[model samples]
Target: RIYVFYGPHGCGKSTFLNNLLTRFEDYANTEEGLRYEVVWRLNIKKLKGTNKSAMSLSAFEKLIQVIDPENEGKHDLEGKDLAFDDKEQEYIEVPCLCHDNPFLVIPKDQRRNVLDELIKNDEFKWKLFTEKQYEWVFKEEVCTICSSIYQSLLERLGSPSEVFSMLYARPYYFNRRIGNGISVFNPGDKPLRRNFILNQMLQSRINALFQDSNVINYLYSSFAKVHNGIYALMDVKSHNVERMVELHNIISEGVHKVENLEERVDCLFFALMNPEDKRNLREFPSFEDRIQYIDIPYVLDVNTEVKIYMDIFGRHIEGSFLPMVLENFARAIICTRLGKKSGAMEEWIKDPKKYQNFCDDDLILLKMEIFSGVVPKWLEDSDVKALDKKMLKKIITESEIYGKEGLSGRDSIKIFDQFYSKYAKEDRLISMPDLCTFFKKLGDQPKKIIPQGFLSSLLRMYDYSILQQVKESLYYYNEEQIGKDIKNYISAVTNEFNSVIRCIFTKEEIYVTEAFLESIENRLLAENADPTRRKEMREEVLKKYTTLTLTQEIMIEGKDISETRLFQSLYDRYVHNLKKRVLEPFVANENFRNAIKDFDTEKFKTHDRRIKRDVTFLMENLSRKFGYTQQGANEVCIYVIDNDLANKFKNA
Candidate 1:
């Protein structure tokens, strides 16, 4: 299979390839029955023109002279009489390209029968025969050189068993340094000139066994090194463009012509190309179908981008920034990589203005969350229900076209270094203000890369989120009293006004009146709701009580009224409104603002008992509920109060 991974440069294409190689090696080592061989990484730019030689006795004589420079081998000897000094030692060098697998040394006609007799496992035999990926094992014939040697040895011995005994199997050691099994070629590496390879000891042994046969030596070529293995081209530019053109036949027909012989190359061909480098293959239009191009786009997932930062800068760097601030930085960088408008998003959300408090106008932030495998809770229930399987698939498919533009991976890292160095401090944790300031301070040229109005929307969203966090942390309402209030309101709405009744759920006495119903209704309904709207809301609640809550919950199932779905929905809104107003009184108090700043200091001990207790409880809950440090809690609280965030998002 020929696969070309094309993407923008510095987007971790090479890193992904290296990790894949490591995984393949680990899997092959652990699994003894794996059918694949070692992957050989090759830089096509380093490959030179092909050269071939004849497989004659004179070639072996020339090879013997090269290995035995001291004239240790008999020059006039032929066949069995050919002898060399130190014949027992295997010190002769053989080119890795000339090496062949022991299984390939067998004759093609009898190889399958031999394997069927040897392998006892039925499942493995079934796979080897039936699986498409393993078809090469039985279909591929031996190389021209191995076939010649096997035929010659068989003719001399006249026995298949005797000839097969000479062939032995050994472990293949993949060393990258010497280009043994795994070799990585670079653009700068010079191509080898010498194509002939010989080992004197092995040649002498072969000559003694096959004295009358014509086969004496075999020719070598560069392609043999990666035969039946992986051939990875680093990039398809520069000299590699020519090399890719040269592999047209090998890629199409699984064979390469070397002089008079055809070499069979069953290899997994892989290459990495930049988006611009794709033009290099334009001259050969036929390659479009032969090569499979896999898109390796920029990092769109915010969490994965943060993990990349943590990997480079260390995980401890997260402690320097406030919670979600570091991720927000990553989110900002990823937003630059996304398209400004999304058809899928627009199709799903017809109006982006409705979610101004949660998402940006472009919905890039929402898309980033989805890319990170998160369905944000802020999405409207109707929109959430509309996210069926087909709609989700369209959204995910749109990601392929994005992450191609905007800030590259290298650019993001450099920008993060600058941002971190400026804001990370020892006195206080980094906050949203620092993040906003860093991007705002950039020059106009760099700012043009970011989508317009995104920063303002991001700041608005951050402000709204932190305000809710502060409100939740400060809220200490009584759950039992709130439940009683709801039950009393439901009972009052169902009955006539000015009537006195005892609550069934809370077992508390209540004097039902218009003011009593208005108090709870004020929290559940809009503040500006007119008298008629309030009356309509009361009637709606009463209708629900008579139809579902009163008849089914109380009489049919005998479940508490609070356990009904209608009650839970109202309870959520009541609590949300209460938390929204929890920080109102404290924001107006100057002592509360000073107390948050003076927290953990000696001055905090002198504050009034009630004020001190409230501050302490807020800070503790901020740390316990949210993953905030003491310093982070103090900073967020001060930020919310000083910015008048309560009033800023009062309607939200």
Candidate 2:
């Protein structure tokens, strides 16, 4: 069968093909991916003689005669480690060809009976070797050369057991370039020939006992080289129509017509072509029918796109000189490729209103995150509850249609290469500005391939990300104080809960309150359900909480029941607002900003504890939180306050 991989240019079809071949080759050589082929010990001299030089002489070898129950052990002779015994024979080993299995050497009429018998054996009884694979192997005929030699050996030896004594089996490895089993053909290659690949020993056997035989040596064609393996056409359309017809026959009929010989080529066929090439091939209905086209489109997932760069450039480019906006650059290029959501997708999504309000950019980004295995942060309980496999499938199908439109990673890489070179030559560090400049030119070009609002959106995101980073640094710097405040709030809530509770079982005062206990239960169970069920659930919760309180005294780390997700979610929201609260007073009040700039320590002392804490917190933690030195952080804080950089992209 011909498997054609189709995609737009720069979608990594070629790279994928090459990598697949490499990985397959590596796996085939391993023990788990083990395959079998037969080898024989031949005697050009006499069978009974102990000729020491026979092993050294390559001319004495004749690879023929397949055997049942062949050994599948690794070849020890592959290494130089030699252990010689007096009883060992010095015979030459020769591997058989025509990609024929050991079972094929049996007479065609006896094959089914023989296969049935072999399958009964413990080694062949396993599910690893399927009946279809056995049938495939059983159907293969040894090459004409091997057949001729086999007949001669049978006539001379007069018994099948004698023939079996000369043969052994080991792992078979496929070589892509040499076309031992796998052949990859590119454009402008010479046509396959029927030239016989005569063995050095067999070349002199023309007038021997097998003189009347039509098969002295096997014919070596490009088609024959990949017999029982794989034949890959790099770009099918690049070749002439005649060459494609040859491939069509192999794909459809599983046979290639050699000179006067319709040889059955048992091989898998693969082809890689762009969308235009695929369209061109569609004109020929017969050829199109035989192909199983697979799409190799550009990746939409942001994380996957980032990973491609990470793998290419390695963990850190130029020893930690990797630009912070490297991911931003990847996202910008991917954004250009995203297509609008399809109408077909609406059928999959039950409530279109849930997603109807989202802008094109927002939808695209959400799809990207979804493709990267991220759930949307804004999803409500109802929206999440409505999701199923069918909905996801439709969403994926919609994304697949859009995948054909995107600007390829290759296009982005070229732009990156140009700017990277500019910075490298000038001995300057790469930055987000360099990437922004590249995208600006791409978006502004006369024949713009990039989307209209791409550059502006990216620049806005970059500015916002920078500001967000600064705020995060501020949050981390004051984390100790924030933790203390959160602890105080928790303590106050606990005190109020303890005061309201009454023990149900002991008829004594209980520490746990009903409302507080219900909150924990609600996280795991339903809300506002049966009273009896709720009471029973509360008992279970009380037991776990009592254990936690006794063991760790309500310390968050020591508690067994999970509360981190809830606590963290609450903490993040609180701190997010706290950051804004801290910023608003400084941003709005010019007098407060001036004090911050002038380092008015005397005036700072006169303020309330909260204001004083905020003032001292910024002064102390800028360097430690962010990646800046003390002087740099101090300067950056003042710059941000003076320019009001936090709200710079607010209008966008």
Candidate 3:
């Protein structure tokens, strides 16, 4: 498309034009006229502009004689074979010397002022008019940039590395010019890799080359050494000049073997000629199509997730000794940006309680990121409401199950599966983009979170997608085995009697209230005569309530028993269930058991180092078992697949 950037001077039209120049290094590197902003890359070695000396045909004719004094209009300059060292006789050197406003070479500061007076259009600065400087493009500034790095590319004579070595090893602007010595130019051997700064300044930019390409633009100020001189033709509309077109085309094509420093002169031909050919050039077959056009999600800009992952993981690794990350959470542990949810601690240091024989609800909440399961009493306090919307939203947004409702069945099922995946696996990053981390935005506020596990049940009952994963893990075991494993999982928690008692029965409100009671208790016992004279405390142990509610959870789902019966059963079997799931197995499994038992098994026994073999085994097994697969299984990044399959996409 034509981008006409015309306006009063200094309004950024030129600045925008410079930006446009940097758009397609990858495209420009191709021998096939890599068109992006350009219709086709062209080599115009004998290119000349119409200027002062070019104002009249005979003036251009005489100037050409200077290049080849022997040639008069009668001699044929067509189909000529001119070597790099050919006498300056083969072509004409037309000087654009117009003394009325002679072109003067001025230093950087004086360039604008000097040109303003001498190079203005005749009507504007009539006192002196040689030739208006055709748009003067400055060369790219010097950089540490190396030339293309594909060394294995069979280049003639000088190498890609050699080209880079010469260019970057010096401090000079870089541009195209007549190359000399030994080298083959054009897209000789390798492709270009983009340069970028570590800072996340760019949200993203499109590559006009190829859509599937992931190229990004990195602003750089470095340039290689350059050379500049103006070429002119007295008149383009003359027969003699028109007849020399073949000579120009020949010169443009003959020097394909030249170093990068020399090859650029070939590139300059089209640039200088762009004004004349811009329209016709764009009409080519290749110019109209795009191999790539970038689309950037705004999420890349916030980068809140990546930062959190780094910080949290750093702290988690530094302080944590006994790590018990679930296998699924292992890969999905990305989305390093934490606090995307809001109000959560920037350093959410809920230390690991593995190998300790008991799991703190807070630790579980930390590992599982299941906000509803367990959290610091302070996290859910009404005071949390005082936090800003982003913070408050982050707090309740942990698990879809415990967050607000009203999601479409598909969405509800999707979120639940993602949470379970991240919760099940450890070290694995959450397969989330920055956009996905949020509770529903209600008006400008986040909705209140219902109790944990509410959404999970609702989705399973409402959306059959709950079957998506269950049928996989339990696919091998019979109902009896599945039931046994389930019971085993539950019973493990009660292996620590006090742990079970403290967990299921401790209401968050009660724990917060106890912090107050515990403080008071210390005060009562502190005074000098407190032992004997303090108000008599109840002469009893801290007994716990026997009855519990399994009603809203089990009974609502109509799982085999009445509300009263289920709670009674939950209370009765709670001892064994907690022992099985939460404590015993955790204390027995090699990965996590040692953390709880406080034993160090030797390295070999604790290792999970079988990479390729296991990955292949897992992929084959999962594919055969689940009927989902992608091309290039081994080569593809599993993070992409995990994120896609989990459907954890949020605002992204």
Candidate 4:
């Protein structure tokens, strides 16, 4: 019967209304008639609007600017031509963000009120009595950027359709929240750590962009997005829109020249949507051609339905407006189509099978974009049910629901259930177990109709997948170096194993130690294999209060001494032992054969310059465990014996 418009600040309620109108014309009998609508007439001169603040009233009149979506780069609205005509149209308000403009100097409040009264003709309220249906207008809530002024503005604009006219036709509000706060990520205690971060931040690669403090600050923002994705430093809030335009240019340039993982993925998405970058690139010679996306006009009547398509659903789905370059693409990755471009303009352009610049590894990333939390409104709840079936099949398979090739229909339901249940409850920490079980407990074959939000949510969750990728990255630098890695890992895990073995278990649990002395060893031994169980650490009688740096040691040995590489090795070793240690006490075993099964210690393979250097380095650590000098080992007394329980009791 009618449309009601509302939502959170800056969420584009007005713009939503405009989009609805544009989509109307695009709809045919099948989608239309099925999608009903109404045509309403406006009795405008009679629209008496109430307001209080002098500045607010001026802002209210500035609503006229919503008629022009592209802000006319003016501080004040001294002369703008807009007059009310009683015309019938079936459309709603186009949601738009707040426009930032100075309020008019209207000190004469009484005169303003009188003028308001004349605009409201009492007889006009009776003209379109579906006036009875005004209350039922479609209303959207939870995301309008400016609720304070919306009410007064809504009244003047009259039901949503007229408001849609004002919004689609204009650029209304622009204001941003700005602040200065230094972010401290991953805090640590020791001086070395503090020194590391402090130094890195001082010479921050991100800071190279600015000389002017104001300009520099205006562009500073950081989001620790899915790990290793390109994080952007964009310009937002600069009064000069040129800053935004320029930033757009730099981002596009960076997209092609990506060298590090940090800049590649992050740069791709951040460059497109983030308004934070005060800069927009209007200068690139091929910018428009490459991106194939254009910001629509602020004014001039936009077809309401079509506008809705663009603002609500179109921009996101049409992510890579420029077609993917098919030749460079892997067949499994893209869905290439060989057809002449078809659109209203019919401008012949190539439409690549897949999206732009995509690769096979990026399939997960593309999927992640669907689930990234910031959802657009056009994708109503039902849309989530209609996901691309083929894509869903691939996604389900890729997620490794059972850590395998693909999921059956039954498997998919379970996976979706678990994923929804956990995320619905807000437990976003999905590890391998959670991932494997994400859809294992579902009971229904639910379908998606309005799937935009869910799709966005999935895509957005790419960060989680990115984090999972770090484990595999140990292979990235040297995939076959697993041989060197296995040895290093075995040793590291052994050291940790020794620490865990001494405290809680019987002597039988720790045979590698000296029967008499190394008896009460480290606590890691004899712990239960249940991952959820707490580890009862042993009494660490052998103190290890020390500091070590493998950087210089790594350099001297002629092995790449990257801290990331070293840490990754340590982490991998720990994980493997943690998985298998309960089943076998191979770590810290006296039986060198048992403990070093995979630890290839052949001098040529094992005792390379790097290994020798590391062994010598570790020898210092081993000596410290025995309270001995670096040159020798000092044996200690063992309190526990590895005999039968009854015999041990008799001896005691």
Per-candidate TM-score against the hidden true structure: 0.82, 0.67, 0.19, 0.17
Q: Candidate 4: RMSD over Cα atoms?
A: 30.6
Q: Candidate 4 residues 1-652, lDDT tens each?
A: 0012222223333344334433432342233323221111212232322211211222333454445556455434567654433232232222211111111111123334443555565555443223655322222121112232234335555564453333322222111111101111111211121111112222221122111222111111222111112222121223223323333544554321221112211222222222333124344445444443322211111122223334433443222111111111111111111011112111111222132222122232233233232222323334335444654454434332211112222333243344434543221222222332332333333222112232232322322222122112111233335333333332332344434343221222332223312221112232323322212211221111011224333434444322334435444444433333221221233332221222323532443354344334333444443232322211100001111111222211
Worst 10 residues of 4 by lDDT: 633-642
Please give the lDDT score for candidate 3.
0.27
Task: Say which candidate scores most in lDDT.
Answer: 1
Tell me model 1's lDDT, rounded to 2 decimals.
0.76
RMSD per prediction, one decimal?
7.5, 11.5, 26.7, 30.6
Q: Report residue 13 deviation for candidate 3 (angstroms).
A: 28
Instruction: Please report the candidate that would top TM-score against the real structure.
Output: 1
Model 2: per-residue lDDT, tens digit, 62-162? 22211112321322346555332223334545566655565566667776676577567576555424567555554567655456556766887898767
* Regions of candidate 4 where Cα sits further than 4 Å from its true position: 1-571, 580-652
Name the TM-score of candidate 2. Answer: 0.67
Candidate 1 deviant stretches above 4 angstroms: 31-129, 142-149, 156-159, 162-168, 172-181, 194-205, 212-218, 258-261, 487-512, 526-529, 539-564
Candidate with better TM-score, 2 vs 4: 2
